[model samples]
Structure formats: C-alpha cells, structure tokens
Target chain A: MTDPVAQPETAIIVLGCPEVPVQQALALYVASGLRERGTDVLVTGNPSVLGLLKVSDPKSVYIGKTLVLETCIGEIVERKRDCTLCIVFAHNDAGIAYAATMCHLLPKSRVVVVVFGKDPEPLAAEINFPCETITEKAVHNPAQLKTKITRVLGWAVSRT
Target chain B: MGCIENLKYEKILPLGASFKECREYVEKNYPEVWYVEPGYKLFDEYIIGLPPIALGIENGEKITFPYTKPCHGTYLLRIEGKEEVERVRKTAKTKKQAGYR
Candidate 1:
C-alpha cells in the first residue's frame, strides 16, 4: 500500500529579487526535489524566472509580474482549500521576507526556505526549524543536493 | 550570490565599522551590516534591488572590508522595478552562457 498522504498539488516559489537566476536554478532543484517526493509544483516570479521556466518546465509553472503578496497567498490558499496539500519556497532574501509576510497572509499554510550558497549549494529547511547551512560541509556533489532536497521536503511536509 | 533579497522600497540606511571595523567586529563577535544599526543614512531616492545595487555598486569591492576603511560616499538611488532587474539578469545570463567573460 502507498502512503496515504498524497503529494501537494501546488508549490509556491517566491524569490526575493527578479534578477537572481542562480536563485531560480536553486528553486528548480528544489521544485524538482519536491516533484520527486510526489508533489506537483508551480513556480511564480517576475519575467526573469517566469520566462526561464517557460522555456524549461512550462506546464508546472506560472509566470507573472508584480503579484501582490496577498494575491499570491490567496491563490495558494484556495488551491490548498480544495484539499491539496501546498508547500511554499520563499527562495532568497526576497523569498524569506515574502515567507514572513505570507505567514500573516495564509495562517494555515506552511513556508520553507532552502538557502543556496554562492559556491557550494546549501542545505534546505522548513520554516521554524533548525535550518542547516552549506558552509558546515561542502555540498558539491549532485547526489547530496538531491538527498538534501528530499530530506528537507519530507521534513517540511510531515509537520503540516 | 544571487540578488535574492527582495526588491523593496524603504529608507534603509546601512552603517558599519568603516568597512574595516566591520571585519574586526565580525572576527571578534559576528558579521554585522553597517547599513542598519543605531543609525545609517540611505539616500533620498530609496529604490529596489538593495542599497548596494542602488549605489551602482553590485558586488565589486567595498571601501573597507576585513578592516576599517573610511566610507568615501553613499548614495540614495532610484529603485528600478522588477522589469528592469530581469532585463539585466537576462542579458547577464545570455552573455555568461555565450562565454562573455
């Protein structure tokens, strides 16, 4: 028998700056990690990320410009209200701030931040948990990234 | 590395231990951004990206780092909206992929 916990239908990725493609790349790993964990994901961002994902994974993404924090929250809340578990990735500083603000917007939703390092990719963490950083041990290997992503997503989803 | 911080408009003024002083501070205590502690001055134009981007200095070098150095100048930049940042990033990505460096 499979685990009764069905995968989340929506994954909200919120990066702080529209300029950071590196962050977008990191988010892609994260979204991919989530997808492997059986969750459907949707990435939203300014034209930068939206355009990139459009060319990359167009179906599972939503590209928009200037989505107010509240409206973004509403969209996710409604989706989850339909009983689909939802997870959020506030990717960077912008994503972090957005996550904090989002907590107020959707009291029922859960937020996570998987901080990516400049050189070696960092570890992932859920909101309100002890987040690990990459500096401790270089996550240079690709397998480590997948392992970390799956670990973080599982850790995050279990709480909610 | 990515300009992951939110592009918000606020009168955020960062101050520190003369860049050099900050290094000492970090070495002894912890990393502290001089931009906002006690009192730092942000320019009147307050823009998006960040105080660094607004000042037209996007991660090159600080007047002081690892030790105390006098701040020569500060700026209050007009924040560029989301569209503009994307334009630059898009260009940068294309150039980087094509071996612009």
Candidate 2:
C-alpha cells in the first residue's frame, strides 16, 4: 500500500520578552487559529511565554508542540525542516533580529513578522525582510492584538 | 559572558545580513576571533535585553566579557576591533540558534 501524504507544517516563532502580556495573547491566539485551519502548528518560545501558554492552554488545544528557541533554529538549520508558514512576533529590536534570523535560515518558508506597541512602523521596518507584516499599538490591550491576529490569519487563510 | 571574562570583549552592534557574512567579515580582517557558545540557561536569561550583537575579545593577554541589551535606541557600550566584530557574530549566532539563550 502507498503511504499517505503528510500534512504541511506551520511554525510560529512567538518571540516574547518580560512583561509583555499582549504578545503572549497574540501568540496563542494565532496558534489556535492556525490549528483550527488543520495546520500542524509548532509553537516556539521562551520559558515565561511557554509557561503562560501552558496555563492558558492547559488542554494543548491551541498548541500541541512547544519548543525552545534553540530547537526551533536547529529544526531549520540542522534538520532542514521547512514550513508552509512561519510567523514571527517582533516587538523590540531583539525580536526583529530573531525574525530576521529565522527568515535567513528558512529561505523557502513564508515568513510573516507581527509588530505591536508605540509607533510600531519603525520597528517593523527594522525587520529588513520582504515578507508580510502586521504592526499595531496593542501593548496595553490583548483584545486588540487578538483582533489584529484574527485579521492577519484571515488574510493568510484566503491566500492558501 | 562570565565564563570568558578573562579575555577582552567588545560589542559588534547591528549584525546586519546573515551570521555567516558577519563571521566572514570579522575573520577576514581579524584572524584572532574565536567563538564560545554560552550555556542554554545562561543564554535565555541574557537575551531578554534584546541586544542585536555582542562579543568577547582576547588580545593575546586578557579576554573581555560578552553583553547584550534588552531594548533599542540606546547608548551601546562602545567597542572596536575585528575580534570584537567576530565576537558579535558568534554571540548573535549562538543566541539565534538557541545555543546561548
């Protein structure tokens, strides 16, 4: 018998920093949306963000695979894993660097950078990649981030 | 980092392009640059500053430390030299690979 075709995977690199609630919410929200679309989602993040995700999504309904920041890079650089979609949450300069690095490693992946906070345009510009971007000032409000994520995901769904 | 304190260190601001390019730029000019991967736990704690680049320096006698920032648009500790530049690329690569943090 012939083997079944494997589902294309989607990787979300939820770049987070200390004291960023909006970023955490957005990451989870986007991951959940991607999961609903029948995409195999891999959520990569730091300890604090992962911890919050675990508490928020204890059932693993939204996020089934949680990887450390290193493993994510290893997947692309070492194992040569490619993704149908790669989302990067960039709120600060460091976040932008991480986004750039991922884009650099996975040249074939469709990478998108999400930016939020005061005057996000400047930061968005810093990403220095030719990919889709979502920028907003939703630092204080998780709801806004959720809305933005939904809209972005809607666009992504239509594209595929 | 604390482990390589015995060597002189410097910061290579704005790694720009890919890690390979950054490394090549530094090595072609500065032949003394070597890389030291930071432990995972240590890396995780430090990258919170969001530093674009950092590096350790060894001037044949003493080694400097590696450091990073959590934010942007601030005064970076001024550093110079090819070794410093290489250090920045190595540090950024390690952090990018989750080898540092």
Candidate 3:
C-alpha cells in the first residue's frame, strides 16, 4: 500500500542575479518546458524578478505558481513542501550564495546549478552542495541558454 | 511623520562574514524593513521601476534589495532622512566585527 501522504513532485526553478538579460528569458523558457512535461513548476525569486516575468508572461501562461524568495525557501526547509527537482541560476557571488542556501535547505531534492557569464566553473564549485552543474558561456544570448535549459530540464525529468 | 516621506535614498551591499551578520546590521540600523524573497529583485528594479520592492527595513528606513541593470548586483536601498544617514552609516560600519568577517 502506498503512503497516505503523497510526496510533492515539485520542480522548483530558483532564479536570481538577473544581471544578464538571458537570466529572465531562460527562466521562462525552463518553466514552459517543465509545464509541458506535466511537472508541478514553481518559480521562486525576488519581487523584481517576479514582476518582470509577470509583465512578460502577464497571463501566467508559461510561469506556474510563483513564490517569494524567502517564503519558498522557508517552505522547502521546514519540510512544508516536498520537491523532486531544484534548479538554481547563478550569475555572480550573491547568486551562488542563494544557490548554496537552497541546496542546504533541500537536502533530499535533486539540485542543479546553472552557471552563466564569464568563468563560471569556479563559481559553480563554490556551491558546496552535491548538484549537477551546467555552465553556459553566452550570458547575453538567450538562444544559447534555451538549448542548455532544455538539456537541463530533460536531465531533471529523467532523474525524477 | 513627514520626515519619513522625505527620506533620501542610499544603496549598500552589506559586507559581512556571514549572511546573518548582514541581516542583523540591516535590522538594527533600519527601523522598518521588508525582506523580499531572495530571487525576485530583478522584477522590482527592471519592470516595476519602483522602490520598496523587497526591503530589509520599512517605514522611515525603506530598505529594498532590488537588482540594477547589467547585474551590478543586489544593493540595500536605505530610504531615510538626511539626519539619520550618518547614524545609519556609522551603525553599518560598526556592525562588522573582527570575528564576524
């Protein structure tokens, strides 16, 4: 018999450090892909990031349930929410910190770190969590990130 | 009360050994702060073009961590009166202790 409480099959796309334009586009791109696969998609970020996405996808067509950055972290860490996949987008020092914090918060969830911009390997290494790392050189180009985002989501899907 | 509405804006990137230190400094210095979730500053800065997006402190000290263009990085915006600026600055510097860093 299956357990009465069902594990949350949530696919969280944690986005921060929107220094690069691709960061916003890539986030929406990934969310759309996840939704297509029938996965519960949750996009977590600050008001600034969420506002942009809201304007871009005003109808919430591609974007799913949006959570404030702290609330999302709190829910995941407190075990109030169960997640199967976690993806963090890191562009700078602070972005890495956010990613590391998420990794620490959701230990059981499969975490993936996507490092963009120049010289991402070192930044990715600082995550300090067991996560799959994907680095992209095209920080300004959203198209390139699209391909990579697809590959990453595909990977997340397979693992789940 | 009127002074709160006329506060000047100052942006800071808190330098602390840990995130907790940074948080504590903001809390002590600014009387009112609202923390926006970590990953959402971009929208408030770019799309909304507004203040008080996700502030650490609110009211007299309208502290918001909104993103700027080109990813200059997240900054703490202190919206306080002119007289309070120096006091806040002094507190911000003093909070970073030898061990905290």
The top-ranked prediction according to DockQ is 2
Model 3, A43-147: lDDT tens digits are 988778888899999889999789876667656655687678888888775666666656666778888888887777766665555678888775778776677
Task: Indicate the worst ten consecutive residues by lDDT in candidate 2 chain B.
Answer: B40-49
Q: For all candidates listed, what's the TM-score of chain B alone?
A: 0.22, 0.30, 0.33
Which candidate leads in TM-score? 2
In model 3 chain B, the worst 10-residue window by lDDT is B43-52
Instruction: Name the runs in model 1 displaced over 4 angstroms.
Output: A1-6, A18-22, A32-40, A58-92, A119-143, A155-160, B1-101
TM-score of 1: 0.41
CAPRI quality level assigned to candidate 1 from its DockQ score: incorrect
Kindly give the stretch of ten consecutive residues in candidate 1 chain A with the minimal lDDT sum.
Answer: A130-139
Q: Estimate each model's TM-score.
A: 0.41, 0.62, 0.59
Predictions ranked by DockQ, top down? 2, 3, 1
Task: Tell me how each candidate scores on DockQ against the true complex.
Answer: 0.03, 0.13, 0.09
> lDDT, candidate 1, residue A9?
57
* Interface RMSD, candidates in the order listed: 13.3, 8.0, 10.4
